[model samples]
Target chain A: MTISDNDDGGGTTVVAGTTGRLTQWSTKRNRWIDAIGISAAIAVALDVYLGIWVTPPDKVQGNLVRLLYIHPAIATVALYVAFPLAALSSALWLWRRTRSPFFDRLAVASVETGIFFIALTIVTGSLWGRPVWGVYWTWDATLTTTALLLLEFLGYIAIRKSTADPERRARRSAIVALVAFVDVPLIQSTMVWWKTLHQKATVLLGSSSQIHGIMAMTFALSFLAFGLLCLWMIINRYRIEAIREELEARRMEDAINDRIAESNIRVDDLLAANTAPANTVRSDI
Target chain B: MAPFALLVLILFAFALGPDRTPLINATPGLFWVAVLFSTMFAIQRSFSLEATEGLHDSIILAGIDPAGFFIGKLLAIGAELGVLEILTAAGIIILYGAHVTSMLVLLFSCVLGTIGLSAAGTMYGALVSGMRLRETLLPLLFLPVASPVLIAGTRSWQAGLAGEHISASPWMWILVAFAVLYICVGVVLYGPMEDM
Candidate 1:
C-alpha cells in the first residue's frame, strides 16, 4: 500500500546543481518581516477595536454577531487566497520554463498557513453555528468541502514527508497538489448548488446579504490585517522550509560522498591484490 | 476485499446487537460502508499491480496511453466492486431483510455511485499506491473526496426505498456529476502523475 511509489521511473536524476546552501536572510529583509508582523498585529488589533468598540451591533443578532468580524476573513484566506496560491505555484512548477524550487517553497508556505486558517475557520464556524443554527455540526456542502480541502492539504503535506529526497519530494508534492486542486472547483460549485445550513458567498458579488455598509468596512479592515498575517506567515514558513531543504540536501550529499569513499577504498584493495601477483613473480623464477 | 467486507458486515450486525429490526434499519449506511472499504482495497490493489517492480516502467516504455490505462484499471476495480456489491446486497437481503423498493433507481444509484467512487479512487490510488503509508493515506485522502458518493448513494437508496411522491431525489444526478468530474480530472492530471 505504498503511496505513489508507482511513479516507477523515479530512477534518481541526481542533478548536482546546488551545494545545499541554507537560506540567508539579510538585515533589510528581517526588518521588512518585522514591519509586516507589526502591521498584521496592529491591523488585527484595529479590527478588533473597530468591531467591538466602533461598529454597531447587529440589529437582530446582538453580540453574537462578533464572529462575523474575523470568520469571513479567515475563511476567505484559507479557501480563496491560500488554495489558489498553492494551485498556481504548482502549475508554475509544472510549466517547465518556470520550474524552480522557489515556487515549491512558496507553495508549501502558503499551504501550511492555509492549514492554520482552515482550522480557525472550522472552529469559529462551528462556534458561530452553535447559536445560529442550533446544531454545531451540519453536513452542509460548504463545510464539507472545507473539511475535505483540509484533508487534501494534510495528504499533500504527508506525501512531502514520506519521500526523503528533496527534489523528488517537491516534484511529487507539486504533482499531488495539482491533482488535488481539481477538487477546489467541484467543492465550490457544490456549495453553490446545494442549499445547506452554511451560506454561500456573501461579499464576493456585492450581494448585500449579511455584510452591509459598516460591516463591509470592518470586513475590509479585517481582511487587510489577516491578509498581511497570512503573507507574513507564508514568508516565515518559506524561509524555514528553505533551511530544512538545505539541511536535507546536505545530508544527502554527505551520504553520497560516504558511499563514493567506500567504493574508492574497495577499488584500491582490488588494485593492490592485482599487483600482488607481480610481486610474487620471484617465487615462480 | 470481499471477505473483509463480509467481516465488516458481520461486525455491523454484531455491534447493532443481533436484532433484525436494528440491522434492517442500519443496513443502508452499513451497506455503503462495506462497499466503500472493500472498493478502496480493490483500488489499492489496482495500483499495487502497476507498482510491481518493472511493470510500470514496461507499460510506460510500451507507450500505453494513460487514459486507456486509467480506464482499464478503473474498470477492473469497478468489476471487482460489482461482485462485492452483489455479495453485500445479498447480505442485506438475508441478514437485514432489506428489500429494493425502486429497482431502477437503486440500480442507477449503485452504478453511478460505483463509477464515481471508482473514478476518484483510481486517481487517489495512483497518487498513494506505493507510499509507505499507503493503507492509511489511501483512506485519509480517498474517504473525504468520495464522501459525496457515499452520501448521494445512500440518499438515493433511502429515497428509492421510501417510495414517496418523489421517485428519487436528484442524487443520481449528483453521482453522475461526480463521476464525470473526477474522470475528467483523471484524464487531465494522471499523465503527469506518472512522473511523480
Candidate 2:
C-alpha cells in the first residue's frame, strides 16, 4: 500500500496511486477506479437480466434483437471512446508539464482494451449480420471501418511490442495512436459513404432520429453498462501495466549490475595480467 | 521507388497475362497499387536515411524544430513520390492503353492522394525506422493503417478514369481530408516521435 515498498532503480511507477501525490489522494484515486469497475460489473449484469428477459422483442426483428444489448455497447466503447482516450493520454504524455508514465501506460492500456473490444465488435457484428445481412462480412462502411480500425491499432500494439524500452515504446505507440485517432474520423466518413449495408447512427450523437419506449431504456442502460465495463477493463489493464513496468525496471537494474561486474573483471585483468597473485585471480571455480 | 512501381506493374502485366483490354480495365486499380507500393518504398528510404549516421540525433541536439523536420521529410517524400507518380501514370497509360477522358480529375486525385500517402507513410516509417525488423515490419504496420487512403485513393482514381456517371468532388474531398488529417497529426506528434 505504501509508495516505496519496493523500489528498483527509481522505477517511479506511475499510477494514480503512485504519482507522488499524498497517500490519501492516491488511495482515494485507486478506490475510485475500482469503484467504477464494481459498478460497471453490476450494471452489466443487470443489463443482461433486463435486456435478455425483460425487454420486449422488437416488433420486426423479434428476439434476435438481443444482440442489441452487447453489439452497440461494445462498438461504441471500442471504436468511438477508447481511441479518443488513448489519443488524449498520448498528447498529455508528449507535453512536459503534464507528462507522466501514468499517461504512457494509460495510452497503451486504452489501445489494448480498445483492440479487444473492436475485435469483439467485429465478431458480434458478424454474428448479428449473418442472420440479418445474409453474409458474415460485407463491404459496408461501418464494418470496413471497424475492421480497419482494428488493424490500425494492431499496428499500434505491434509498435509497442517492437521495442523493450518503455519510454521509447510509449513515444512510438503514442504517435501511432494519435495518427490512428485522426485517421479514424476520415476513415469512418469515407467508408460509410463508400458503401454500407449497416444502419446509420441510432443511439449516439448526430442521429436526428431516436429510439423510444422500453427498447430505449434497455439500450441506454446497456450503453452505460458497456461504458463502465470499458472503464473497468482499462483501469485494471493500466494497473497491470504499471506493475509490468516496475518489473522491467528491476530487470534492467539487474542487467546493469551484471555489466558492472563484467567490466570490473575486465579492468582488473587489464591492470593485473602480470602482477596479480595466482590465488587472488577472479575465481570461476 | 520508380523501379519498384515498374516492377509491380510488370508483375501485374504478367499475372493478368496479355489481355490488353482487361489490363486497360484494371488500369485504375493497378495504377494506385503501384503508387501505393512506391510510396511505401519512398517512406522506408526516407526514414532509413534519417536514422543513419546520428543524423536524427544531431537534428534533435541542434534544436531544429521537430515539426519542421517532419514537414521537410513530408515534402521531400511528397516531392519524390510526385515524380514517381508521373512515371507510374505514364506506365499505366502506355502499358494499359488507358484512354483518359477526365484529365483534370485524374491529376487532382494523383496530387491529393500522394500527399496523403506520403504524410502517413512518413510517420509510420519513423515509427518503425529504428527497429531490426523495420523492413518486414513497416509494411505490416503501415498498410493496414493506410487502408483508408487505399480505399479513398482507389475511389478517386476510379472517379477520374471512369467517373462519367458520377462526380469526383466527394472522393477528392476524402483525399483532402486524409491529407490534412495526417499532416496535422504528423506536425503535432513529430515532436514526441523525434524526442528520443
Candidate 3:
C-alpha cells in the first residue's frame, strides 16, 4: 500500500515492500517508548511505596500527606507540562514557517493525554480533599479554573470532530488550542488574588522548607514518573493519529479506484449494447 | 436579545421562588447572567446575518480590512448587548425590587463588560460560523472563555449595587484588561480566521 503525504508535506511513501526497514525503525522507537513506560510504572510504584510505607507521617496531617506524592505530580503534568506543550505545538502549526501536520498531531496527542491527567488530577484531588478539606469540591480559583480548562479542551476535541477535512480540522483546532491557552494565565493570576482552600505549591517551587527528606525525594520521583507516563501516552497517541490518517487516505484512494472501475464497466456495457444489432434495434424502438 | 434577556431575568425569579430577599440580593448576578446568555443569541444573530446570505465571503472579497470587519461586528453586537443589558437591569430593578446604589460603577461595568463579551463573542462566532454544528458548538467554545467576564462583571455589579464604588473599581480594571486583550487578539487574528 502507498500513501501520499499531502497532509504532512513529507512526500509519498510506500507502506508494504519497505516493511522490513520501517518495522526496524518503528521497533527501535517503540523500544524506547516501552522502556519509558516501564520506568514510569516502576517509579510510580516506588513512589507509592516510599510515600505510604517508608516516609514518616507528617507532623500535622499524618498519613494524609501521602497524597502529596500523587496529586501535585499529576497536576504538574496536566496543567504545566501537557497543556503548555499542546499550546506550543498549536502555535507552531499556526505559524506559516513551522506549519506541519506533525505539530497538529502533537497538539492533539498532548491535549488528549493532558485531559486524562487532568481527570486523574481532579479525581485524586477530590479524594484527598474529602478527608482534609471536608468536602469533595469547592469554588476555589484553582478548582474552578481547572474545571474550565477541562471544559475548554473538551470543546477543542468537539471542534476537532466537527470537521472531516484534515486540513480544516487541524487549522480550526490549532486556533482553538491557542485561544483556550489564554486562560492559563487568567487561571494563574486568579489563584493569586482569590482566596483558595487549596494548598500553595511547595515542592516544585523549591520551597522544600515545608517538605524535606524522603518525602521530597518521593515527591520528585512521582513528578518524574507522571511526566514520563504523560510523555509515553502522548507518543502512543501521536502514533495512533498518524496511523488513522494513513488508513483514511488509503480508504479514500480505494474508493476513488472503485468509482473509476465502476465507470469503466458502464462504458463497456454501453459499447457491448452498441455492437449488438438486436439490442440496438430494441433501443431504437 | 432584549426579550431573551427579560425572559432569563423572569425565569430566575420563578426559579428562586417568591422570596424577594434572595432575588434582591442576587440582582447583580442575575442581570449579568441574563446578559451573558443573551450575548450568545446576539452573537448568533450577528453571524447568521452574514452567514445566511454568504456575506462573510463577499466582505472578504470586497477588499474590506478583516480588522475593520471584526471591529464593526464587535461594535454592532456590543450595541445590541448594551440595550439588552439595560432592559435586563430594569427587569431586575422592577421585578426583583433591587436598588442600584452606584450607577456609575454599574454603567462602567456594563460598558466594559459588554466590550469584552462582544469582542470575544465576535471572534468565536467567526471561528465557528462556517461549521454545521455552530449553534451547539458556539456556546461550548464560548462560555468557558467568557467565564472571566461573567465573574468580573458579576462581582463589579455586586459591589456597584452595594454602593461600594471603590471596591468595584478593580473588577472594572479586569474588565478593561480583558476587553483590551480580546480586542487586540481579534483584530490580529480575524484576518487569518477569515481566510480559513
Candidate 4:
C-alpha cells in the first residue's frame, strides 16, 4: 500500500492500495455540522419551552398532550426519515454500479440513529400512555410494527457485526436491510388489519384543522428540531464509522506486513544457516 | 420434526395448565407457534445438510441455477413443516380437546403458512449458512420477519375452528399474499445471497 498525498484543499488523505483503489480520509470536521448541531439544540429547547409553557392543554387529553411535541416528532424521524434513508443507502450499496463503502457506512449510521430515535419514541410514547391508556405498552398496530422494525434492524446490525470481512458484511447487511424494508409495509398492513388503538395522523396529513394554530406551529417546530438533530447524529455516526473502518484496514495491513517481515527474517536466517560453516551451526544449536 | 413439534404442543398444554377451556381457546395460536418453532429447526436441518460435506460448494461448482436451488430447498423445508404441522395439529386436537369446524380453511391456512415460513426460512438459512453463530442469529433474523405469518396463521386457524369461514378467508388471503411475496423475493434475491 502506498500513501499518495493529494494536495486538495479538502485536507483529504488518499491511501492507494495495491488493487488501485483509493481510500480518502476526511479528518477535518465541517463547520456546517457544528452549525446544524447548535441550531438543533436551540430549536429543541425552544420547542420544548413553547410546548410545555405556551401551548394550552387540550380539552380532551389535558396536560398529557404535552408529550406530543417530542414523541410524534421522534417517531416521525424513526419511521419516515431514518428508515427510508437507511433503506435507500442499502439499495445503493447493493447495486453494482453505485456500490461504495460510503453507502454502507451511511446505512449503519442511519440504522444506529434510527434505533436511538425508536427507543426514544417508545419511551416518550409510553410515558404518555401510562396515564391515558392505563398501560405502558400494548400490542396495537403502530406499536407492534415499530417494535418489529426495531428487532429487524437489530438483526441487521447483528449480521453486520458477525462478519469481519468488510465486503461480505456490506453485502449481507444491505440484503438484510432490503428484506426488512420490504417487510415493513407488509407488517404494517397486516397489523392494521389485526388491531389498532393508536390515534390516526392529524397534523402532517393536512388535517391540521383539528389542532390549534399555535400548537400546530410548535408541532412543526418540533419536527424541524428533531429532523436537524437526526441529521447531525447520522453525520457524526457516519464519520465515526468511516474512522473505524480506516483503522481496521490499517491494522489489517500492518498485520500482513508484520507477517511478511517475519517470514523474510526466517528466510534470511535459513539462508545464513545454510551458507554458514557446519561447525558454527552446531555451536548455535 | 414431528416429534419435536408434538413435544412443543404437549409443552404448551403443560404450561397452560389442565384447564381444558383455556387449552381449547389457545389451541389455534399454540399450534401455529409450534409450527413456527419447528420451521426454524427444519430450515436449520436443511441448510446443515448442505453445510456438511461441502455440498454447497459442489452445487455451485456443478453450475446449478441458484433460483432452482432456492426453490428446491423451499419445497423440501415446506414439505417437512407441512407434515410436522399435521402432527402438531393432531396433538393439539387430542391433548387440548380442540374442535376443528372448517377443515378446508384449516388445511388451506396450513399450506399457505407453511409456504411463507419455509420460503423465509430458506432465504435466511442461506443468508447465514456457513456462519459460526448461525444457530442464534437465524432465529433473531427469522422470527420477526415471520411474525406476520404467525398472526395470519393463528387468526385463520381460530376462525376455522369457530366455523367462521368468512372471517377465515381474509386471514388466509393474507397468508396467500405472504407466501407469494416471500417466494418471489426468495427467487429473485436467493441468487445474490448464494453468491455471497
Instruction: Write down the C-alpha DockQ for each prediction.
Output: 0.40, 0.65, 0.69, 0.81
TM-score of each: 0.84, 0.84, 0.91, 0.92
Interface Cα RMSD, each model? 2.2, 1.5, 1.3, 0.8
The order of the candidates by lDDT, greatest first, is 4, 3, 2, 1
Give the per-residue lDDT digits (tens) of candidate 2, residues B12-68. Answer: 999998889888778877877777788788887787777777787787788888789
The model with the greater TM-score, 3 or 4, is 4
lDDT of each: 0.78, 0.78, 0.83, 0.85
Identify the leading candidate in terms of TM-score: 4
Candidate 2 vs candidate 4: which has greater TM-score?
4
Best by lDDT: 4
Model no. 3, DockQ = 0.69
lDDT (10s digit) by residue, model 1, range A1-285: 121221232333232454232244410157888899999999999999989988888888888788888999998888788878998998898778998888899899988999999989999999989998998889787887888889989988888888776667777788778767776666555554454667656567664656777777987898899999999999889887865664555456556765675666667769875333333322321
- Where model 1 places Cα greater than 4 Å from the true spot, the runs are A1-32, A188-195, A199-216, A257-285, B164-169
**Tens digits of per-residue lDDT for model 3 on A1-285?**
233333453445433331223323332356788898899889888988998999999988888898889988899999999999999999999899998878998999999999999999899989888988999998887888898899999999999999888888888899899989976676555544555767767554664568778888998899998998999899888877776765675667665765675666667769885433333222311
> What is candidate 1's lDDT per residue for B98-182, written digit by digit as tens?
7767777777788888888898899888877667888888887788677777767777777776664263556777788899988
Clashes of 3: 0
Off by over 4 Å in 2: A1-35, A203-214, A258-285, B57-64, B163-166
- What DockQ score does model 1 reach against the true complex? 0.40
Q: Pick the candidate with the highest DockQ.
A: 4
